[model samples]
Target: MERPRRGWEIPGDHVVCMYKIIVTPNASVRGVASKVIRYASIGEKEARQKQEYERFNAEIISWYETSKRVGLVMISYPPEMFDAKYGGIASLLSVIAGWNVSMNEILRVKLLDVFLPEKITKEFEGPRWSPDKIRRKLRTGGEQNCFLRVPIYPRLAYPEDYEHRIKCLLKKAPEIAPDIIADSELLFNHEFCSIDKRIDIMSKFNKHVESMMDAKERVETKTGCKTLFFINVSGKPSYTLEKTEAVKEAGLDGITLNVLTTGFSLLEDLRSKFKNLIIYARANAHALLTRGNSVGISFDVLAKLFKIAGADIIYTGAPCGSLDRVKPLDDHVADIRHRNTIVRNPIYNIEPALPSISGGVHLGNLQVNILLAGVPLQITVGDGIYNFPWARNNLDRIADVIRLFKKAIYIITQRKENMWDDHEFRELRHKKCRTYFMEEGKCVDPTDKEIKDVLRRWVYPEFRDVLEKWERGK
Candidate 1:
């Protein structure tokens, strides 16, 4: 699935948009290659003939390397999306054919991957975590992502000069696993404690962690999620420990910690204390990826490393949305996960964790997102859902979008259980899904597999294509 590139503007309702991506099909399967063409659906073979068709068994890898566009992939959206004022899908073809757009000139890049809630570049727009509402809106039984996010802001503000605001932030968390994204102020606030090897009760942050333990019951009841809070623990570690311990005691599930900024041992300590806590590992060194370093571990490897350090999940920025979309960088993400398989570190016995797709994810990229993130995707949308100008009932709409995404995932991935696999969450995805939305008191069957197929082919794709075209450059 593709994440929107930065600098490429968009609108909430508009359907079609032009997308540019760099793909190294050579590293695709060995890296991010989604499917093998030799063994493809019958109709897919015919479609392959129409566009750029590589040798059937000669390998898609060859086309990836030899094409003068040599990994350059630019596609136009559905034709209906075009107009004289705003060119349609075909216009994109014309632009690429006539214009010479350089990778360096593009400001944003969308990193395509399987998980939501991954890391994002600072440049990518509202794709940034707003400390507001965003993400999937589940309204039917079909739509359900194991993790359902609820927005909870810092209820109390710390004095500008106060040293303990970070302490206060951790203190306020009712629960911590759904994953929290705070502004930088909350991330590096001097008042926040560091991760400590030994848990302490006397520390102000420690006290907050202990306090949240009591509040856990209330939080669990309120969100109906047992371990669903990711606190603002972006500061350094020993103090990060107090935050981790607070997470442990409060039964809060995770915290977003910058892995590159802190050592792996910090995560190790937190993992040691709480066997089940989820850590959202953030890595900032991914900037090197766009330059085409296939061997370096890159940010994707950081996910593997963090998992070794005890992170439950890691954030990989998007090719677009909150960051510029760079095709080469997207290839690097695939390389990190596929090519650089993490060797088990002697530091600890660890399992393969999940990668998150963060930055500017919203209702718009649903299908392409699943395609890009791969199955079992975890995407974070800070403003995409909340920032809608035409949305009438924003809350319900968000939930509806979430539900649609879940249903879409189910349909697209062809999996029945485990909406969130790595975390192994089961019932959580069900929370957002309602089997039916009433129409005249009669249950409407919107999700019967047959009807769903009809809608996807006959409806959704067309409509999505239509609006996306005009959304470009918005």
Candidate 2:
């Protein structure tokens, strides 16, 4: 049988928005060539006969050529040029980013931004579960005064080459429990550890699936808190989908998708197919992030695009913790999540996509991360808990780490005078409380440098060894 169509395809008749982008030429070009063809006519002899066929559709809005290496050109197009029905992500891209990439020799035309119309955004089913729903589902503990849903995702590994890591975590669940346990993104791709080629992915993943279910049981029985377990489904598109189907059939909670590895178009396709499965889109900085450098796409644009494409949770970079000098990126991501009205497409009542702050997040700067990322955020940490030097041998000590981190988050979010004003964490607070705060349906602005400095100061110095290891490996 013919292979099933991998996903959605861009048809020729889809309706699109009046999209525009700025194109910068590699070298200065003549004015005639700079304009994108809109109503080109062939030679006089064939012009009459081929009038209908010869019209190349696109309008050049503006052009600025300052020098040989630097020049800017703006292009606009009518919505009728795109195939609206079958073109979800791919169709939209064909107009915005698809063709211009290959034209680098003549001009470095990059997509600075697009003003998407309501007609286009309405086609997507944005996040199925909002931040509040996710918080209720996972039940990361806090009070009314406490910022309710700052969920945590802790990356895991099978240390003993068995299901020992998860089992240990479940046994310690009575004391400390993580909101979500996630497989390392590289694990599914065989980069973290080599698996026997003979073993099918289902067989390799079966034990983890069972272990996650077992952990769920223990958490419910002991702590009464809910937990979500997401397995990394990373690989070629077809293979990843196969794994996803197996996980869904097995009753696992979700899948962690490295969107960079799978392709953004594929991610949207999966979202359409697996409506119930929670998809965590991790922008691993391998694909879109690198491509974004050449184009003008920043983390902010990428995050909002993923949301429009129906991603539930997106990995929105780390600021001042493990990765350095990305505070602006993080702030813009949070802005998209909380202030969806400002940055999102206007047609749909799309719930704000949850922005997850990852990369070296731990108990030390956990409070800082939560504050900076804003409430209703998701926090992901790996080495911070697993490789804690003091708890290297004792798995039970993870409870203390969770307890302390939650305590810190609660104190900072609630701003309880008695709890932190005179406490040790008092020093962790910014002298001016520089954080994203709600005001008139928007986040109050704070300089990226100020937030970065305060968060850096709050980082736990004890984890220097772990941070050093991450830097070296990176």
For model 1, how does the per-residue alpha-carbon lDDT over 99-154 read when each residue is reduced to its tens digit? 22222322222222211111111111111111111111111122233333322222
Which candidate leads in TM-score? 2
Find the 10 residues in a row with the least total lDDT in model 1: 114-123
lDDT of 2: 0.51
RMSD per prediction, one decimal? 18.9, 11.0
Candidate 1 segments whose C-alpha is farther than 4 A from its true place: 1-227, 288-297, 319-324, 328-349, 390-474
Q: Best by lDDT, which number? A: 2
Clash count, one per candidate: 89, 5
- Clashing residue pairs for model 2: 13-83, 14-82, 14-83, 14-84, 15-84
